[model samples]
Target: MKKFSYFLAVMFLFTAFAPAAMASAPEKSNKEDKELTPEQEERLEEIKSRVDEIKSMDFSSMSKAEIKDVKKELRGINKETKAMGQGVYLSVGAIIIILLILILLT
Candidate 1:
């Protein structure tokens, strides 16, 4: 039980300091934002306008089918936006596994 408590304390300290250490590290070149092409920018602007139009619409008066169509359109837009963005996305499970690996290695 004492060893378990000590292990927990060490884990807590490690997790707390890990972010600080990472923050102090130099930023990678990939972290720099890339300039969007003219076509991409125009498409993004169109997407924004469409989203605004959807937001301003009265959903209560719309038919169920129309609402479902609108939702489908929004999902497509979400996929497009995600595809346009560049980043590494880690799921909760992956993050937990990474932390476990670090703890075990230490």
Candidate 2:
């Protein structure tokens, strides 16, 4: 019984500290932050702000399911932005083609 209790205590410590320790370890950069363009900086700031909000969130009183929803929301925002860029490219091409046809007709 004593051995089992000790094992449970160690297991609890690992479960609590492992993720926090790993999260603090810095990831290696394939690119420099200063070299990033304005658009890239803006996107990074937007994501950082969102994650900050999520981190400040009171997880002490919430369930795991709610945390999952927050991740899903962030992913959805990224997908929407990518689609909007594609739409903008399509619109620009169509406008150029229309202008060329109008010039030819006149």
Per-candidate total of colliding backbone pairs = 0, 0
- The clash tally of candidate 2 reads 0
Off by over 4 Å in 2: 1-30, 71-106
RMSD (CA, Å), candidate 2 to true, equals: 25.6
Candidate No. with top TM-score: 1
Q: Candidate 1 residues 43-96, lDDT tens each?
A: 999999999999999999999999999999999998887777733477544565
Off by over 4 Å in 1: 1-18, 21-32, 86-106
In model 2, what lDDT does residue 22 have? 65
On lDDT, the candidate that comes out on top is 1
TM-scores for all predictions = 0.56, 0.34
